[model samples]
Target: MTDAPALFLGQSDQPETLLLSRANRHGVVAGATGTGKTVTLQIMAQGFSEAGVPVFCADVKGDLSGICMPGSPNEKLLARAQEMGLALTPKAAPTVFWDLYGQKGHPIHTTVSEVGPVLLARMLNLNEVQEGVLSVVFHVADKEGLLLLDLDDLRSMLAYVGENAERIGREVGNVAPTSIAAIQRSILQLEQQGGAAFFGEPALRLEDMLRTSLDGRGQVNVLDATRLMNSPRLYAAFLLWLLSELFEQLPEVGDPDRPRLVFFFDEAHLLFTDAPDALREKVEQVVRLIRSKGVGVYFVTQNPADIPDSVLAQLGNRIQHALRAYTPSEQKGLKAASQSFRPNPAFDTAEAIQGLGVGEALVSTLDEKGAPRVVGRTKIRPPDSRLGPATDAERAQIMAASPVRGLYDTPVDRESAEEVLAARRGEADQAAADAKLAEARARADAAAAKEAEKAAAAREKEQVRLDREAERARAPARRSNRQTPVEALTKSVLRTAGSTLTRELLRGVLGGLKRR
Candidate 1:
């Protein structure tokens, strides 16, 4: 039994330890500031690494980097170890450092698609309508086969959806322009808050985080969160995305002898603050179900009530440090925290919760049968590594030795939704110009045809007038010939008439005398 590995927490009436097999069931470390919560986390991380389980934790105060360096023997540490009857060793764990800003450690990034629209809307603090619009934008990008790799891709997709809202709304339901505008404003705000550095190609993979050292000890990955904590929403959203990614990618392993990886979330309150009911439910579900995938999640927060009850119920291990009961609300919280633990007969639970010293905590862990053991008042052991932040020179040496240094150091900008939409716009613009040119040529051809028809009509009219003048000139010659013929005939007729008249006169003189 002595050979079986266990995490040495501290002493109750006797020495107490946390079984490594049940670590995947999850746990919580709650305390007020200056209550030694960081030390408890460091000791646990060291234990998990020695058990050959990888550990991932956020470093909010920059102190956690010290875990990568060996500890110095101090009087207080030696006295505590002697009092607790522990053979304490001072040694450093194998560690890999990560930073979102790329200044303190290896840069970690995830594509916008992997972030998805639901978590992104939360990160941007979008309203319901804006969230719906963002979802529609993602839908459009997916349907069009556009890859959303970064912030620029998302922004371009938003613009494209807004410009074609009316057309797209017909097929994919209503997309309001006002909603699109609001989402755009939110994205711009996120960009200004260093969101651009978070979303891009060569995203982080879960395998990289689960690596073991050459000596068979697990690597402790410390995420530098000093700058990231400034943007609380971004920090929360990123952690949530990482959890969901692990849940989705890892296969079911049931309960193993030890977890494949252990994740510790610091400043855990931001994960639930202002989160919608749907998001909260999803988080709870992930916490409940991720255990089967051989991953344990530990939440480090200032208050016990910060975690939702559904999630808190899944935590099998509880290490609660001191809580200040100065105000009425704090006293009530103190009472609630006291009632949660399985009672210890040695002391009052409520009084112990408020009176626990800096390194003391009310600890309860799962037994071999998966039941909560009796609570014990424990003095947490100091970490085997340094208890403060690592120097810049030390951090630089660690990053230089990392195998993934070259993989994520240089950012890649592959073809994505932004480029695809720009090409589409270019093609559409060219098609419009071609149509306009064809319309103009048609108008010019019609005008030219009308002018030619008018010219042909005028030439035909001139020909008719010239023919009439020629006919008039020929009419005179015809008239002269006819007149000569008519005059000869008339003269002949007059001479015949004169001769007949002479005869008639002779006869008519005698007839006239008779008639008179």
Candidate 2:
């Protein structure tokens, strides 16, 4: 047996300890509603923190916030710790509270692009066709280099895509108006459900959740999810996004001495409930591969069957509290839960699961060789932290001392898709107006030119008429019987001929005829 750094889960046939080295392999905590699941999660979270591993978990019932305060164990808890040979030191994990609504703790924010279309569609409860249209919209935004930072940005982009559907459809795919409208309605519904606060600038930084205290203890990032539970999809989507962010950003670390971070997904059924196949496949993929990044994901749910078998198979450590098998479905759940653990000749695993008490559980963890250890019935360890939710004043003090105090408190509204699209619309309107004005000016100029041409023609015609009348008035008057030029010339010729003839008669008639 290796004496590596480990968490002493509880006292069992032997000590039930989870080797820190194999903690990255992932785990699960399953039980009924009041079967000590929350307490188990609390202990595991504080254990990871004390071991210098940062932890992130949702405070579903608001009670998990008590992890930020030191414990004051009663007689029963003290007796349990004493029985386990553990020194119950009253100390709290260094905790930072986070909230999606920015009410109970520091606000958590992420952009629309960060969430992506698949998860965003899931958040909006969109149908397949609507989801496809949303993907197209996101593709257009990305191709255009538009930032979808907030809900308003997404709304504007949706409207823009809808208006230019035919044009954008040719480039990407068909963006049906009905699908767009459906998605728009879904977004509006999401906004009404208080999901709008989660999408904006100053988004969550992974480093903030991965911080270690000045004293070398890991910070427990407690996400207050009391109200978030109302919007179950939003809560699930946000956590999934955070996990994805870690998976993408963190470098591969293989198996280290311990996990760099431990993430607890409480009310985990919400993650898989009504999840589409593509999204379910993605969740399984992330859960399967994220261990190599030195992160451990532990799911806390009411039943083991709440998790898919593919994902369930990846969990190396399992702490199962009591469960009820009244109905066939629940009986099946019980059977499945029991079958997950290696058989214990000491007792039937299924009956053991049902018989477990509030603080008692069946603990099974990976052995030194990375094999499943033989199941053991264990008495769970008492948390060194407080057992319930923190007071408002305590949460306030914690928030004030948080490392990321003012970083994401104020919402940022820089120029994004919304503003850019608005500007585009404004410019388009102005261009249309300018074109109309130009057309009007052209028509008016044509009318003016036609009128000027008609006026010039009228002036020219009047001038010709006046010139003709003046010429007539200025002319000298002639007798009505005045002979023409041809007539006068003929008369002169005749007179000359007559005179010549008279002269010729008197002298020579031949000379007069020659002169004529």
Query: Model 1, 327-425: lDDT tens per residue?
Result: 998888888888889998889999998899999999998888788889999999877999999999999998889867788889989889989888889
Overall local distance difference test of candidate 1: 0.90
lDDT minimum window of 10 residues, candidate 1: 476-485
Clashes of each: 0, 1
Superposed Cα deviation of residue 100, candidate 2 (Å) = 1.2
In candidate 2, stretches whose alpha carbon ends up further than 4 angstroms from where it belongs are: 462-516
Clash pairs, candidate 1, are none
lDDT of each: 0.90, 0.93
Model 2 C-alpha lDDT per residue in residues 335-392, reported as the tens digit of each score:
9999999999999999999899899999999988899999999999999999988999
Off by over 4 Å in 1: 1-3, 448-516
